[model samples]
Target chain A: MILGRVGRALVVSELVERLRDRWVLIITALFVLLASGISLYGRSAADAQSTVTAPSIVTLSTFLVPLVALVLGHDAIVGERERNTLGLLLSLPVRRGEVLLAKYIGRALALCLAVGVGLGVAAMVLEPGHRAALLALIPPTLLLGAAFLSIGTAISALTRHRATAASLVVVLWFLLVFFYDLGILAALVATDGALSQDTVAWLVTLNPAGLYRTGMLVSLVGTEALSQMGLAVALPSTALKAALWAAWIIGPLLVGAAALHRRQAVTG
Target chain B: MKVQLCDIQVRFGHLLALGGVSLDLRAGAVTVLVGPNGAGKSTLMGVLLGLVRPDSGHVMVDGRPHQGLPRMEREKLGYLPEAVAFADNLSGRQVMRFFTRARGLSRSRADAVLSRVGLAQAAGRAVRGYSRGMRQRLGLGVAILSEPALLVLDEPTGGLDQQGLTLLWEILSEWREAGRTVLLSTHDLALIERRADHICVLHDGLVQAQGSPDQLRRDVGLPVQISVTIDDDAAVGALVAQLQRGGLADVQIATDIDGRHRHLVMETAPDDLLQVLRIVDGAPSSVRDLRVAEPGLDDVYERLLEVTR
Candidate 1:
């Protein structure tokens, strides 16, 4: 459905507020500097006769983009509620669903812009030959950012305190980004590496960050490397991976919106 | 438009925020809700705004039930919360623009409201630097931006000084003149007493009494107190004896601490006011000063609370 005038205005208002926040600016700058540093390192590796491609960008973003997205979105709802502005906003004609959707779209726009600028400039400066692979990496990286943003937005809606929401988002980030792969590895080792290839592929696809990483790697480095590393046995097609990423972005957002709708507006 | 609350009941956890309260807020009039702290005024406002759902009962605005009202219909209502908080980073003008835009209005409208609230000079300043009263003015500006048919204000006079209070009354009067409905919750009895067309006294989550100020006084049966001061002690004693002998059983007399002035506090019905004045004129003592005090909203409020307790 088309967002009405109120929804569009909410998005614009949220964008303006986010752009003015000092923390958002700092995090955007950090994304640019870090992406540039990674691109420069890849260039040095290329100078040493090693090939650098989209997998290099994916590895950096597997850690950096999710953090930036989380920081940008973790307080989207709870912060407004805690600060007493949500009451004023909800008192208007806008529905709770519109507010939540507008916030997600607004933050998503900022995340995409930051990631595009950071990676776009870096690709131009360091690896002009591999610019196409870098460009291919941007969409999956953005999907990854959107996925984490959805999770953070959900957590924000479930809590009333900003500190509590921030803490929960950090825990979620660690579990999905850092611990998921380690848990998979420990499971493989405990099974004496005898787990079926299909099982391993399904497990890898379950984590959004892992799905993003593998999707980027297969796109840029071909399926041959993934097969050799035993990470691509039953790997689905590119369309399937994109669909999964979309699910990750849209699913939690709907759940969060429902939760927000069920509750009363914050008041003093 | 008129707003009607029908047997509205709300409970938060174990605390009852509102009992089965019914009220009719008429159009083209200002309804002042007076109550003690924690008397469910805020919760009632929330119910009216559709922010807090009632456990039982519903509200009807202008003829349609609140839930049945379309988004455009709901947009015709405006609300000013007890504490006005905005994005501190945004300038006052930007805050207004944000709200105006959210309601599908233009920046020119925002500018108009800023000027209307007398905040045009400080429009460029960040809200973080605004005083409490200035923030309230900004809140007022936002509430009136759409020229809503129904305006709900919660303690709109909380941080206002005398001038701000006067300005607020002027705005309310203008809105009433425009044939819009204004529902406000306030504890400033002296300020709202003369201005409210209807007064609803709420206590302990119940509508203890609701009427026009005079109607409430009549319902409560509170008397008009007439205090007469006499400079001479002998005249004070003689007037007290004469009032007693005149068989004015409802009149109670007491001397001031100086024992020079006699206070004849009488519970006279409205019809007897003239007779009471004549009696005082015919008394044996020369009345140095006479003060007639009618039971106002404050007195009605206190009496209701005391009777209910």
Candidate 2:
């Protein structure tokens, strides 16, 4: 049979393996619970107030998305290679690129399920009346999750040791999710609240997750409130803005697939 | 032909892992690649399985080239690496499922393969708890799951104990009886001596010798050792000297046992036994036990190595 037909089976097997693993399952559940708790607390705090300036859904998603991405992706390829299963995968007629793509899709799907569970619970508890509003965020959140995993897959493929890959991913996550904001804050401080619009536009574009978070916030708050918070910095006309974000998401995936395609199963 | 490698050369940095290695495997036969460490056994297996690309030459499956063939081609090839690491987080069933999917087999079929590998009881147990031999057997089970046209294994008996080895040999023998090609690389001389049909001796990144076991023994020109018991060791040295001097034999003293009953064992060509007996007539009561040492693949391999060196 053609491998493409078997692709879903391979992916499902990976999903099952991930689900069966005690550490991964426990950690994933804990992460879901943490996201659920944060979502509930943030929504309650926002709703208890008489005003609805900023949605706590955006706050919770932006934090939880990267956390989930980092956790799910950091070990996918390197860990498999380290465990020596990568050679077994390569020995099969499956292309290296296909394995990478299948794994990324499989883990992203599992993470999406977790995100659904977490958000579903949070919505049931805090935003039962805003089900439609909460449901609107799922697609973009899934895209964000996929994008981060693609980057993580590429990083893992390039490193031989899992610990090194995890350490590097940790540093990368800190920079992209946390340190990049600090750098922007430093730049903002240096400019003495006189930051040029173009500089700020480029800064946000440099971090794909930041761009995704910004887009999610804009979608939730509407143009007027987003403009009030200066969060809608240079989001182009809607069509162009969507294309830019799409590029930000798929660019890493394309690069990752290319890298995976050229890699040989040489590690023993 | 089940698998064919033609003039393949795989180089790793400055090291040439396989230099112009070529061989063919036939169905229902055990083809053993025997060599010392770093003799390109693993590299050759990797090339055949399409896991490693050679710097030169091509691998053909059945009659067609293997490269660029879709994954379906690989589904017909089963491989067991020398050192196998399974998915630790997965249960044995889950791990088998991965290989089943890779081979495009049913999940139910996977359970059957796991059972065949003696992993039925541990099917639902995590692979992290499996012993090394269990993991190796699991790997073998995965390799043979599809009943592929060809099976490529690297040191399949590396970590197996006597019982595990015996069980694996039985499985391999059954596979052989079913008209499947089994191309295995091993340093276990005993296994090769007992099991291999077509033997290839690889030395220093080259094919040093290739033939069937009997044919290889002849080609290697190994000595025939004879253990003959004699009554006295006093005349053994002179007997050896007289045999050498009279152009009677190339006899070498292998052992000299001294006790209330003394015996001496001499190794020589099986054809020269009559001449040796004539030379030992000086000690008429010397003869007791006599047996001809059967030539083995190890002797063949050693002679081949000596000639190449």
Candidate 3:
């Protein structure tokens, strides 16, 4: 339904709006500077051992991209509400699901563009061999961003106030991106072997940020930490991780659609 | 198209927005819902648009019942929201083009409607730069872009200046002449009392009253006023006697400060209007000037509110 004519209209509208928005511009600029700076710095210490330093760049993206994606998309619905345009929009032939999908597409595209251009520009500074690693970061980073955007849009739909949505997404960003793995480790320690390694790894899989970290470090052949925790054996192929990411994206989208379904009509 | 709202009731928490409200919108007529703030005017329009689901009700368009207007029916429906807004960065032309695509209208219809609303000169300017009236005009442009059979506008005149209001009124009148059904809500009593063909006075989620403007004015049964100026002081008593003799009571007579020219005022019931006029007409030699003041829709609405209180 979101690929229909009306859906195309809303998608193009959101794309144009996001492109022209000042906040989006600022975030994209910040991402570019950070990406190029991190890549340049990662090159400084990586003269040996795989010789590419993709880990540092992946780590940077694992933290930065999701944060940026959430900040960009956390207002998808309530922002329209505050602008007093939500009623006019919902009154159109478009459904709430179409609007949520449009916002996700528009924001995901913007976030992906930032990831590409930022890393691509940084790739120019790297040796020809290492540039491939920087380029590889783009796909997974975009997947990570796409999933966070869905979560952000879900948060946007679940709340009525713009400030509340914004604050909630930030709190969630911290919980997922920064504290998720640490909390899992803490849980394992506190449980005194009660939580199995498979159970612990499954908990990590639930967090997009943790799953992305594990997938990147594993594919880069950096299993020093995971081997110790039995996570190296527990986690399998990139394809499985990729499917999980797809779930992360689709699950939040369905949640957002459901929230919008339950959304009440506003009064003047 | 003819529309019927069958006992529409909406509740927000414990507060009932519409307490079993039913209304009929006849085809080719301007039916306005008039009420104060929180009187559920917008909510009622929301029900008609199929945006808000009533607690228990059915909306029928052209005799077909619907939970919400079907896609085919929604295509014929257009709406202009209160406090209309758009993406601030797009030019007015671009905004109209976007709506044109959403409504699945021809691409050419966008520019045509832009110029029709007189936004042609400023069409290339971003919406942020447009004044409230211009933005409202753009909203108007979007609503009529589809030439919808049923056009609903909520508080369309809230922030408009005189020119914007004139444009709105002109379009509404043209739509009425062309037999398009229009529904709107407003609180500007004086401005709308004349423009609406049929008015529904809504208060506290109830359809307190509904009818033609004249019918409502008569329904309220407010006083019909007659004012008279006497050519001579001696003729004042004769005219008052004639009016009293003609089954008219409550004649209030007052003389000028010079105690020369006399003025006579009378307040009578709706049924006595013709009799009051006839008596004043029969005393033409003594009555130098006569004026009749029929109760306006505003007065009728005000009287209804008083009774409701």
Candidate 4:
């Protein structure tokens, strides 16, 4: 479609501009490297007695990839509006749908490249057997990153202020990454290791990061080991995890696109 | 023949961006929309560009509604926004190339368009380094690309030097001559009067008036002033008597110069003035510079805006 031309131009232009901003690009690349490095080392330490395998690499991605996804996605909408380039982009023949779709697809593509580089770095630092597992993680990693970016885009579309959007994103990151764990710890303490069945079920599966963790761990350690850790029953199976990832990514993407379209109607 | 908006209405929250606005843009004719800030000029432009949808009514380009306006149809419609901001990292040439490619034009066509806009010299320069006027010219160049059938310009003359203004006017004139409709929204009334074949005055979210410059001035029907300077007390009394006896319409003495010398000005037509002149003197003495000054477009604009408000 001719409308796709605008999308292509917009993506190419965004990529070129981001590439020219060396400091930001370098910082993002470095963050990916550091996160990948941390995951590779942590996995090796956790598996000291056993040989690292493809599944072990999947565990590393499940833990570390969310961090990269959150950072890249939260700036999508608010940043363009802040730069005052959104209006210029809208004035083109490109429909608002195309613009949103392009932004989502383009950012996802860019993130894929970054993740590829990061995965390569992780492979380099990990045991040779872990490479296949790391490769297996790419699809979900991309979906997870897309989900976070979509949430960020939704937040951006909802507000005029980029700082406000960024702040909310940070709060979300804290809740997903650290506060969920804190809540789980408090629940465990309150229950004296005898929490109610429903309470335990809810806490373990509340966060997407937690889902990624238990799912990847179950996939790695097998059903029997997952049961010993007291999580196989509470956590969803690999199939359910796959479904959640799809819902997490697709739901927000649709919501963000709808919001963007509505907002454009109001403003334009 | 090219574009027309029929009783368009656009509401922005509590503000009426365009309230029952209508316009007709004919092929090969340049119509200028002139108004002050917040007068809905830009809103009308936006409607034509299909960026903003009207609350009611429709925008038609060549007998087809804007919703039905095909991409191929709009490929012939060139638009230069009030102030365009391109990618800073890309050269002006690159920016032009991107737009041309988007418009489905060849790379060589983009080069020709850039050359037409006088940007060929600085084609290699980054758009970040372009001055406001140069950027404006580049925007116009983009608007003219693909040899568009309709060119919609929003404040195209803004930030341009006198020479640039002349060049832009010449280019616009050429477009008009080539049977391409040009719709320009500007604050430059003088330029509109000079270049636009049709002028629309927007005020308070409505069209205050629309017509040729002379027709608008005539419809406003401003008063013509008659100025006179007399010698002393002797001539003052004679002038006043002559003006009164002349039986002119809306006749009134303006000033008395310290009970002796006086300056009298009356509102009367030039052709209707010979009777007053014959009464003032035997032929044409004592009275000096009996000039009849009719209203211009500026006066018409002020009067129309004042009455509408």
All candidates: TM-score of chain A = 0.93, 0.85, 0.92, 0.79
- Per-residue lDDT tens digits of candidate 2, residues B9-38? 888888888889889888899999999988
User: Residue B125 error for model 2, in Å?
Assistant: 0.8
Clashing pairs in 2: none
DockQ of each: 0.54, 0.57, 0.57, 0.24
TM-scores of the models, in the given order? 0.90, 0.88, 0.92, 0.77
CAPRI verdict on model 3? medium
Candidate 1 chain A, poorest ten consecutive residues by summed lDDT: A47-56
Model 4 regions lying over 4 Å from their true place: A1-3, A32-93, A125-137, A161-164, A183-206, A219-229, A264-268, B64-72, B88-90, B120-129, B222-299
Per-residue lDDT over B115-171 for candidate 1, one digit per residue giving the tens place of the 0 to 100 score: 888899999998889999999989888888899998889999988877778888998
User: Which predicted model would earn the best TM-score?
Assistant: 3
Write model 3 residue lDDT over B268-292, tens digit each, in one string. Answer: 8989888878777777486777888
What's the best-to-worst order under lDDT? 3, 1, 2, 4
TM-score of 2: 0.88
Candidate 4, residue B172: how far the Cα is off, in Å: 1.9
